[model samples]
Target chain A: MHIQATGNVYRAKAVTGIKTVTDILMFGAGGHAAAVSDVIRDIEDFNISGVIDDSPSLQGKCLFGSTVIGGRQQLYMNGLDTMAIFLGIGDNLTRARIARSLGGREFPVLVHPTAHIGTNVSLGEGTVVMPRAIIENGARVGAHCIINNGAVVGHGSVVGDYSHVSGNAVLAGGVNLGERCLIGIGGCVLPNVAIGQDSIVSAGSVANRSAPERHYIMSPGSRIFRRFEK
Target chain B: MHIQATGNVYRAKAVTGIKTVTDILMFGAGGHAAAVSDVIRDIEDFNISGVIDDSPSLQGKCLFGSTVIGGRQQLYMNGLDTMAIFLGIGDNLTRARIARSLGGREFPVLVHPTAHIGTNVSLGEGTVVMPRAIIENGARVGAHCIINNGAVVGHGSVVGDYSHVSGNAVLAGGVNLGERCLIGIGGCVLPNVAIGQDSIVSAGSVANRSAPERHYIMSPGSRIFRRFEK
Candidate 1:
């Protein structure tokens, strides 16, 4: 498979027939992993070989038709050179930690066929754009990030590494999210707002202003007494 | 076209190339109609013949290249047998009234190509599932409903007739919405919650419990002292 980098986006070109399917080792076998597995099954070119989960109980169990092989140590068994990995962990920090531990290994960016990714969108390695997620024009999604079901990353928005934009969340045009940020379900970040690293905009909360690092922009009612006004 | 009924769901089977393009008359010339029109254009088998609106200002005006002809009387002029109708009105009550007046007239269910519909999903006539909307497994959407942009109908949820699930709204698994209900933008109805008839869930509000009939569950701040508490 030949990958051509245009601007910041990497577009993969298939070598017809020979590269019909690529084996992918899934990291994490939780609920998010199940969802990601559904998307991987829908996508024609990718195949899940096995799941890698830390939980001992899940080690021999099957998740979405794929067996949980072992923990992070299983990566060595598959050989990173031949096996591509998909980060299935939902938490931003844990996903980032696992990605960093892999050294410089690049994971394939998985986008569901139903997702409407507009022109000039840049998706980093190991980023999984879920079903019906819209990453609009000029939006940049960082590595190991999860743009979950029906989420909309509006035009010119920048989602930093290891961030998770939950289902039905909307980051309006030109919005910037720093690393490890969590834009919760049904959350709406207004245009041009910047959310600092490790901050979390809770579900259904509308962020009209910038939030500092490690802040929690909870629901509107809770925001009244909170230190951060916006 | 042979429409096979399996339980509550109707699956329409295509009859080769003979019935490729379907002539559809849109019954609203408003902004919501324009959004629906965009989806109609994207669909391969459907074609918008014209628009029908009661307002004189909108009449003869073009909406997405389709001109507004007249009022409900225009349906007779166009011959309803030849052209299918789509209700593009945004208001739940207004859309319900319009659908009732057009008794026995079935409308085509429009699903945007980018929208992800899971297995065994049942969508009713005149229902419009907009771009990036996710209708998960076993979910049932009623007639003339609007599942707007980036909205999600979670697994096994039931949305009543003439209802509107607004943009970025999330109706979690097994939730039930009564007839003519409006789940507003960024609103979320938690799992198994039931919203009564003609109820309005205001934008960004989270409904953790059931709402009674003719109620309005406003945003978080407004939910503090409401008469009809969910």
Candidate 2:
């Protein structure tokens, strides 16, 4: 039941003719959902019809002006075949699990207008690239990934499915991130480094070398280089 | 002789009418120059006329397809009044000194079209905001600064004159960076922290506390938190 993007279907589109606005259902209601909602509002191609959250309390509540229409039950409604869905969740494993649960649903790529996606890049289905994020030329971002605000996926890099490159994180050129990995806030993976599935480069941490699956990088152990004269 | 930007004259312009391309002179031919030139090519407002480097060997050489026409002498040439100048240098002290040397010349603010400058953001004269950089709401970036590639000047942050926020660096909300400071690549300044003049937060470092003038913060000495089975 895992929904893999067939071909280059989710690549960013260049609108050459009349604009068509597609109604999309946002799949979460957390902080990550709010961030993706902001980006979706900025992009001209997508209209947020409703937010889908499983919480009974949130069901009928307003999320960023969109109605919390219903939960996974709405997925069974007719007319879902024509509508697109976007995963606004941030957690790697949870996002991956939910993405796998969907059956043949159209998951469209949502890229903020301010984000720069270079030529020859392949963005997989249901991936949401946030404001000011950069995916350099020839990079491949797998399905259901979140390239968060100001994050950089450098040239020729491969971000496996369901990975989250958090705000301001930098995956330097040719770095490979395995499925369900989370590069935390302000984390940096140095050039050509490869981290396996479920690995984490912690916030403000630098991964200068590769690590195997499920490794955690602890960092920002500071030293005062110079306390200058007053 | 220091050329101060009069009023809000250097703000990013919205071209609604017929496009008029301004011929711009690049002030340096270094690596920073190449980066800014790449951004300028993406924005449709300005055309790169030539490059100016003080290095004698670089004179008449090519920089990113622009000819290294001449050095400081071109600053006084006829028709110079119409051409805009951009300081393509990265060094904080050197950029400041050179900016002060120019008198009455128009130093335009060059922001890549892909960069997101939010409401009420003020980018100072001669400042170059590189690709995918973000200046959030009510933030004020000072004159002649480099907000480098994928760098985030968070909401309400203040970056003082001649500073460089390096690639993928994050200045969290309300962070204050003083004049001639350098926040290195992947450096993260935590929310509301203030670093005084000539300070440096080194690459991959996190400045979680305020520092006084001329301080150097070093970081990213790492440790393994968890290593998993292959």
Candidate 3:
């Protein structure tokens, strides 16, 4: 099996040609993890074996009725190759770091039943699409990304690896987002606009034009989009 | 049947005690009409008899495979009581005017199959909830309102009559919106903020505080919400 790599951002692919339901392990135990667990339950294609959070306090605890078995060290247990890992972390940087460190593991893409994913859309592995999100036709979302609740990735839009498109945000048609970026809650990226790597389109902000790496795009006044120093 | 009335906005209740499938008439034939048609097709409860548009050119034309039967005058033709009227107009005042002019008609509430309407939610008659919109638990949406695509009315929020919550907007939990209000596209109203009647929260803006009647709320700079002259 050939795997692609870029820095710490490895591009994971969906497990294909599998006949039976697979046992999946969740990698984090946060609010986003709970949401992903809900989606997993809704999808019903995989059995959630247990949660694997690194925190010692969460050890032996429960998340959404799933037992928190242990930390990442548990992945090395018997039958590791058969069990798939789900990236449930919400932070982009931390998720990307985990993805890079944890190599050669299957990361299946999970999408909620209520989400509207149009034809010709491509979702990379480890990406979790929340309930009621709309991914219009011909859109592409990269690996380990979080397309949060009711977010709209417009037609032909491309979201890079480890990005988070927050709740109720709208990336207009043909918009492009680089890796590790965040399109905040209720954020609006105008049609065909491209946002660079590590940039943040602040909550309730609008991005009308393209911006460079590590910039902060926000709305200054009514219906205006401007770039400010981060 | 005892029907309740409040000025021009009579609260139309959902048709009850009907065993057989009923025919439904769409009231408008614009872009919003097209979206409402999509939702109707998804729900598959009522048969769409035809469309009623005021435009002369649209007469005899087809909307989502349904014939544009005629204007409001055609409603007087035959068997009107059996057929239910769906408010498909996007404009608040226009929809309210038509609702007022056409009295003694049954207006059933329409919600899309993809939408997540939480427990204890109360949706009034003639209200159309578009695809992927979310109405959280205990929320109340008044008569003839439009909850557009991917919009979110948070938990326990109350939205009044004839209002339009546009695409991707988010009204946080406990928010109250008065009649004929417009929460524009990508707008975010903070938790417990009460917007007055006929008020407008501009697109991509955020309302952190409550405002009185007929005012405009907009977000300036990154996260500050303020009132402006409409």
Candidate 4:
């Protein structure tokens, strides 16, 4: 029997002698892709078929036992129904755009078995809940988000679409993150706080108050500024 | 068969027919208690008898399907030998004081089943390692401590008695935290850093330097101050 979760529901498929493992194609060739490959290997349910990267230099290179087969256009050439797709990009905006490009394609939610998700927690399509991450009761993690290793989504917290809650970052109770936000490594959002769309709370920073759209909230007393704006 | 783990030891008790489940009493009636209740429910080997809180306002209130029984005096009035106790208080100081008040009482360590405790890690009596928490190789966590949800005690770290390592906090390799310290939410203690007794590193703060006793360290450029002092 092979158990696979699609969307938020799990279904067990009966197979004869050996289990039928699914083929999963990784959609990036960077450091984040390497980490996701490790997690996919650890899961043992899927075989990494190949890696897809737009960078010309990465083509034909190997990562996590799979070769970089081709560029982003190859995803369209190959049948999308033949294998599962996992978003391996860490940047929220890039990931969101790639996800939009692959519109309506099957991107199963990949939750590492070690992750502890509490009652009534909803993980959206293509979201990856990594090792030792905790999504507490009533939390809703949006589509294509990465709830990274050892991260915590406190009770009733809302993580918006394509947001990346990095390793050991915390979203305390009732905190709301807008689309494409990056809660960096070991960062924390206090209870009931709201961070707007495209905001980046830098590594090791504390977000105690509400932040506006497109702002970068760095170290304490440092000015919050819009990215790419002088 | 009933298997119970104490410290680093697991003992199995043979029982005829149905397995014996231990009754556990929660020591606090707060948000943390609700979280711990969910973990206890997930474990299945333990049953929550009720919650004990000293607050007069919350004495009869129900939380997570369990009613708050009475004051601290009820603990002694009821037979302590019958059930195990789990500290659900989030504050290190209050938990320490309550543990001391319940002198000589048995407080079994509660580790969430999903928590990853690596080789040779030692968790002391009354310590609660919450869901998805990681105690890496050779780490030692002392008695009556809270290793909150998704917190990571890195390789060879030593967490002292009555300390509270909050959700998603990271104690990097070889870090040492003294008794009654609070490593706040998403706080990161750099490799080999030592925090003295009764100290607190606020949420999302990085502790790169050794902190003295009874001080609160918040943001960069902020002077550490004693709790009672202005």
Candidate 5:
């Protein structure tokens, strides 16, 4: 796999020895991963190493200047380099699967110092908390999660690994989310709501009740999004 | 005029630079000043000599262990030693009034390292940019302001002095606000919305139009709070 240097600062783990050559390996090369790659590139940090994907159409080509570095079997950097990693998989399950496969390796969590973690909270490794996101006190987020830009995780919430909480989404207090979930942009998950794993919450929708694992579309009048006044 | 030896960190600023038998001076001992005093105490980097206020009800009482130093006229610490001064006023006109009253004595601007700032953003002295607040490119924020936690300022936005952008509020591209404006929590101001100074926007409101430079109440429809399965 070839990595075309983009003249940007390489992203490294914040740890002492790892920051010197902050290269980053991408886990998935899909649309969500592409968007995350854009943020990483724009952030003035992190160098993209290469992607590891099993898609036949992408196996031979480069995504974001990094070659598809073959399948899961061929992952790893031949012990020649030290780098951090970001899980670019969309679904939480995919993220969890990939994370377990690579758990022995180091994937430092990336919390943009700009994220607002209120009074007391614990966010685990491989989680990327983006700019302006708010994780209120008593919130617990597991590994390999993406709390995107301007997202809000209200107080006392628990999010399992491989969950992608998109930009401007709000999760009220006591909300519980299972593994491999995707909470889309501008979505609101009400307080005390529980969602099972492998769920896809659509953008701008309001989730008020308990939802089992998998996809649930908000029907008409389920949520209100429009307001116009000075 | 007197430092009462209050133990709280907020009162410690009153004792910062006082040798044996020290006197403290302060200004605008109000709700805003109370919080500002707390931060100053945390700074421990400055000296609070005394206070200056004409409010009759608070004139004789001791705040943070420092007595109101006989109004604005007697604010000068006759023979006391001080490292710096603090402008505890929350109003733009009044804070500026007191700063001008000091004639360049120096009040520190506190910019939290966690605050996200874009290129060409302007901030004034004594302004505190709270954690996770995003000051976008070319945004101008004036003096003695409180850009609170998780607040977002979009590109080309102009925010006036002593303004408080509450938590999780989003000001889309090019929003302009006047002095002493208070934007409520979880509010969103659409692009190019011009709001005058001293304006107050309630929580969970999505403002799409220009507002006068005064208090504006927003009534957002009932939010579903969360999404769940049907």
Candidate 6:
């Protein structure tokens, strides 16, 4: 109400929704971490407050001006609900472990604009779907999941929470993922197969049949080879 | 005139376009065959008239009602323009061999609807992008390429024709792909590396260094490997 200030024009601040200023904790320090950080940066409402990693070399390093903190050796991020934690880990097994350590905390699910998620699809809280991750019609995803970059959750699939479908993994129609399951990088699960929870399907494997709760290591030939060569 | 006589429906033949078919001999018949067959079946334009394979077990099987004619020691579709050949091989090195054998024929490029191709992205004829494949902004994809399921071509990346980026492979920004290159399953190429044409990066490899060609391979830990271990 100051009449003398009429000649001076001030650039107006853009009005935003009431729920602004979301804080986020990123879970990795590698290239994938850097990439996810960029994605979180693109979102207007969220700000990456910090990163959690076990790498001593990166513990004090500045990642886009955020300090890297340590967590449970496996669960490298403190699951404090005051801020949402994102699983920047690309590996499924590690992601599942981290998700469990964060036990029952509210994880904010982030779906990138470029992604195409269809109707009748249920995505759990705290899951992050990168650009081009297509969740087709009739898909059910559980809580605390990580749908990595370019992954495909085909029609009529069920993925439990605390699971990580690695970057580029393809789960064909009607594939059932038990809780905390790990579908490794580029793994292909054919239609109608059920993977038990807490199980790890090795990277590059082609799963056409149901498997129990354990590590199903695949050889270079995409076959069920001997157990993982430690 | 026929509506009353034909059970309340006109029986006139539905007018349809006769798509220009690519005369081709299909090679490989497995999971990749299932996907390629699905595409071929969906696109009535290309008549995938027959299939050829060296596998004794699959030699006589029918793929999507199309019979497997014979082994493809040599290209043979009997000069039918309605058929254009496509390689249904999953792995990269195997496809390279198949590509060499079918040098004279034309392969039509197939792009799935779920793919998000960005601006200034140039894709050559005969390249196929499976579902959820993302060819980002400023990417130039060359001829005879196979950008498999859920693969990512980052912005400003240049992939030469005849190169195959296997399912879920990730190429970072400004990367250069040489001609006839084969990037294996789940491989990740770091930013700004120029991979020489005709080279093969092994599956699960993460290439941080530039790969000079003739022939070269790399593993995930950035160790030197081979394209095909005999």
Question: Tens digit of lDDT per residue, candidate 6, span A67-137?
Answer: 87665353333454455567776556677777777765446666655566776666666566666677877
Candidate 2, pairs of clashing residues: none
Clashes of 6: 9
Candidate 6 per-residue lDDT over residues B1-230, each given as its tens digit: 00011110111111011234444456777787778776665444456677878877877788767778778653544454335667777655577676666666656566665565554456665566776677755578876578887788876788986788987798876789998787887876766888876677777765656766655555424457798978
User: Cα lDDT for residue B150, model 4?
Assistant: 74
DockQ (C-alpha based) per candidate is 0.18, 0.29, 0.17, 0.23, 0.05, 0.06
Instruction: Report, in order, each candidate's fnat.
Output: 0.31, 0.57, 0.30, 0.36, 0.05, 0.09
Per-residue C-alpha lDDT of model 4 across residues B1-69, encoded as one tens digit per residue? 111233322212211122344777898876677677767766666777888888899888876677888
* Candidate 3 docking band: incorrect
Give per-residue lDDT, candidate 3, residue B31.
Answer: 88
Q: Which tens-of-lDDT digit does each residue in A1-230 have in candidate 5?
A: 11111111112223212333367778787654654554454454577778878787788687766788777666654742334667877566667777787756667555553456665566677777766677887788877888877888998998887787875689999999998877864568999999988887764567999899886745232212223354
| lDDT tens digits, residue span A128-227, model 3 | 8777787887888998999888889999999999999988889999999999999877888999999999999977888999999999997664432222
- Looking only at chain A, give the TM-score of model 4 against the true structure: 0.84
For residues B35-105, could you state the per-residue lDDT of candidate 1 as single tens digits? 98888777766778888999888888888888888888878763665567889899888998888888766
TM-score of chain A of each: 0.86, 0.86, 0.87, 0.84, 0.73, 0.72
Which residue runs of candidate 6 sit more than 4 Å off their true CA positions?
A: A1-21, A69-81, A200-204, A215-230, B1-150, B153-180, B184-197, B201-230
lDDT (Cα atoms) of all candidates against the true structure: 0.76, 0.78, 0.78, 0.77, 0.64, 0.65
Model 1 clashes, total count: 0
- Candidate 6 lDDT (Cα, 0 to 1): 0.65
Candidate 6 chain B minimal-lDDT segment of 10 residues: B1-10
> What CAPRI class is candidate 4?
acceptable
In the range B192-219, model 3's lDDT, one tens digit per residue, is 8898888888877888778877788766
| Top TM-score prediction, candidate number | 4
Model 2: per-residue Cα lDDT over A124-163, one tens digit each: 7778878778776557888888998879887678999999
Interface RMSD of each: 8.1, 3.3, 7.8, 8.8, 7.7, 9.3
Order of models, best DockQ first: 2, 4, 1, 3, 6, 5
lDDT of 5 by residue, B1-230 (tens): 21121112211222222332222245678876676565555545444666667777777778875677666655554553333556666656677666666764544565444555654456665676665566654577776677776687765678887777777677766789888777777766756888876677666665657877665747445666557767
